[model samples]
Target: MNRRGLWSVRWRSAVVWVWCSFCLLTLASLTLRYIVLYIHPDHDTHRERWCPPEPVESDECYSWRPVLLPHATCGCTRRILIRHTCSEDLSPKMWDGQANSTCDPDGSVRGPQQLVMSISTPFLTPKRLATLSYTITQVNELYRGWVLRVYTRVNKHSLPSLCSLVCAHPNLDVCDITAMSETANTVHHAAWRWGVVGDPLVSTWALRYLHHALLPRDAHALTQFINSNKCWHLMKDHPTHSHSVLGSGLLAGKTSWGLSELTGIRKRILLTRHVVEEEQVFRDMVTPVIGRDVMTHDSLTCYTSAGAVPFPSRRSPGQWVGMPIPTLTNSPQNQNKSHKNATDIMPPQLKVFSVKYNSKVNTTDGFQIIKNQADNDDVNEMEREHINRKNGIPRCPHSCRPPLHPNWDYC
Candidate 1:
């Protein structure tokens, strides 16, 4: 071979070797990243570590485990993606940005303040289980500093699946209500009785049980700060009666005072022998504290039989956007049946949108409200863009469009 040809051959061989080496290095980097994320060195240690018991007086001992999401952190860029959605990412603005800045390394927000939620169900069907999982995931994503307490009455067969769901998230705790005699004997019995007879009183008893059971040790401090109510509470109210409709009868409050007031309502319900609704109780408790100024006509719209309605634009800022539960069925027969009543069965998928707040609004008073509104706006914009792209619609360029005139013809 000629000397020039030999030099060309050697150079070609060197390029091929370098390319192979680069590919190998890239593969190794990706593999290491995957291992760091999914198979953490401390994963086994964290899983094996004993969970601390709740500092409360109760026969039923429950422990809380940290919800570990690789993408989520106590910073501006934290995001948690839901499992079954169309790869739609949660808005970083959903959580209070100020709170994020002050968050501890452990992902907890500073101060004695925390959000608490309780979800209970008598039976855990596949559909109900998915809904429960979605709800918990949404809570974890939206409220980073919040603690979710889940109580389920599932059989031994379903226990592992429930545990898998709970263990994956941070700031989440689960208690098998059926496993505890204290709860099983009283609240479980009441729930079953109410399920059969549609007795409102019996249902109220079950709610009361959860209200007290799910409270943190520092629940007493909830009402201490009148102007700056620290603890927020939300409880999922499942249908206890056979005839009751599947609705988002979620009981929520800006402060834990609403939870504490349940005791007073329980006494009132006993004295009057009246069928007092839980929604009515919540409204009576919260209306005075949050004030009539913040509430709109549709503020209590989720209390309706139709489930979660679209949040009105004029509604109070900082209120949670109502998420409609989608009818998720895998069976062909069920899908066909669901399609017939698609309007009724399948509501619009959960979309979090922000409401515009007055610029003059006090930042101290409406910090969370403003943050949520901004988050919703960003999420809504992203969702709209996603839909447009799916439908082959071109997104209008932000540079060409002015903020004041969104519908300008030129844009």
Candidate 2:
């Protein structure tokens, strides 16, 4: 019994040790998973806990608590700025005069008769807020017939600040898409599903099409599209190209510039007089700067010309006509002085507009417009030439003339 019993006991001991080790490892793995999940919860699961299953009018439906980061100060908590209940109505409203108009002789409802322009941005920083406000003022002043709508991502707490910044213009409506769900049956939900998640290239495309679809059949309207980063201004009237769609061509392919063609596509804000019948044709004509087939390198149509709206160019000098021009100074004394007298230096039109809003924003931090050295020099030279011409002096031929001297009257 000595040799056989000893071997059998050793084998049984090995089997028991292996099974105990396996059970311990499994228990440890499950514990670690639970710990990780407790520390950093899944976003979808958290959303489901708060967001209502159906549209609700209560503010509690969109309530969100501030999230504190680990080891961070209590003041450094991250808070969602805007949140709206699913039932909250944020639809665009027609201008006052258009409200009374009928669709046809039969007194039926028609699509939007007024020009509807829209712009979308996920983040609404201070700079974007100012640009948007200024654009709205300009649109209201220049094109009284058009209606502008703004779509951005923000939470309930931050929305009032934005609305106040924009002065809550009647012709413009600001819509928030932060709480939009793809599964919802609302118009915004449909557009949200159409958009490619996390892709900024086509972020505004779906909303633009949605607005067009809501318009009256064969309606004659103009769509002025741009992103939050870009500013739009009416430089001059282009009645010739008013009926046709226009966009930029400088960025047709990836090789054209180091930037993606999609960036150029954002610059291609179309101004169309009539809505097209087909969706594909409408997209192609509305956004000709970048091809519809984003995966392929198909030839893109560029429409940069006199009639086309001027887009910010990475390679060329920036235009100052429609841009905010801020005096640059490093001296703290000068900066303080500039800030104090900001309203005095503003254009008469802007001064008048600002009075209407009674905006509380510090003028010094109103809007920051960035321009390159070449652009600054070009703008300076143009101003000098204008002064000389006004005083009955001829423009100096820079090519033939020597370097400018203090005593020189002409080249």
Candidate 3:
């Protein structure tokens, strides 16, 4: 061939070779992606599990994870894009301005990172299992979602100090504690209120009441607090004020969640000072009527009347079923009104039946009003007969007779 034709052939061949290599690489990449997709159809760079087939009724899909990177720390400035309909980025106001802000979403990932630890058949470490138990208590405070405790080794080498996500629905059986821990990153320990008795059942009613009654009463403040993301802070910090802030319009507890189901599904977020704080809160609440040590046996007898204080409603707040439950009405705003006048704000004809203050009753009469409720008349009659057979003075009216045993007494 001629020299020019030979060179042209060589160049064309080179060009063809480069093009073929590029096409082959592209095909290989696509094949790899398909294989990965088949294996993990729900994987995401964001670490959130891909949303399964579900009704997309809401504005945004419910994704709990945010891919917390190792770089981000509390109060640090990181560029993260918040995809929620409400905001473009995580604002400084959300974390009480303790964290720095940057509206830029170029690189930073928001929220908790997906736990990368793998799961095995059984966890192998005694020490890590112990630490995991401690970690679960901390995680339960923030994320109340259901998870499983796993105690197994990965690859038979790495110690199992890790928690895995237990989201395998229908595919897996009982979830392990390891799955629960995977949902959170570094748990910054904070002081939480003790034994406030967080029944999700009660919380549902309480939250509804707060949203309807309490929020409406002080609409401006409530709106501001909610908008500024201060409601969570108030709940965590000023627990006493939290009740008033949300309780002014609270309805009574309901019975939607069966006790059996609640016990199984609902998890307890154990806090450090649960019992101590619970006692303090109770003392603060009932101190005016029963005084300190109101949680004692004497106080318990007084609390028997609690059932008679009707709960709000099973569904809606303020909508009574059998009877209306009594709630404290005097917010700091309107505390000086006459007790009788305060009834105007409350449901008319509703009374705190079967509940009476010892302070409200006089103790002078031997034939005082029967302390036993009218509902217990049969039991009272039996007691009366027994008392008469013994040494009986006439039945003590409006109260139960003192037992002959010196140690036994009623408050």
Question: Which of the numbered candidates is closest to the native, going by highest lDDT?
Answer: 1
The C-alpha lDDT values of all candidates are: 0.34, 0.32, 0.26
Relative to the unseen true structure, what is the C-alpha lDDT of residue 106 in candidate 2, on a scale of 0 to 100? Answer: 9
For model 3, residues 31-100, the per-residue Cα lDDT tens digits are 9987887798534222211211223446554434332232221222322223233443444234332312
lDDT of 2 by residue, 178-198 (tens): 433322213332222222212
Tens-place lDDT digits, model 1, residues 292-334: 2121112232244222212212222122222234455546454
Please give the lDDT score at residue 145 for candidate 1.
42
- Global CA lDDT of candidate 2, please? 0.32
Steric clash pairs (candidate 1) = 66-170, 67-169, 67-170, 67-171, 354-376
Question: Using alpha carbons, what is the TM-score of model 1?
Answer: 0.35
Give lDDT: candidate 1, residue 26.
100
Model 1: residues with Cα > 4 Å off, grouped in runs: 1-114, 179-249, 254-276, 280-320, 331-348, 351-411
Better of 2 and 3 by lDDT: 2
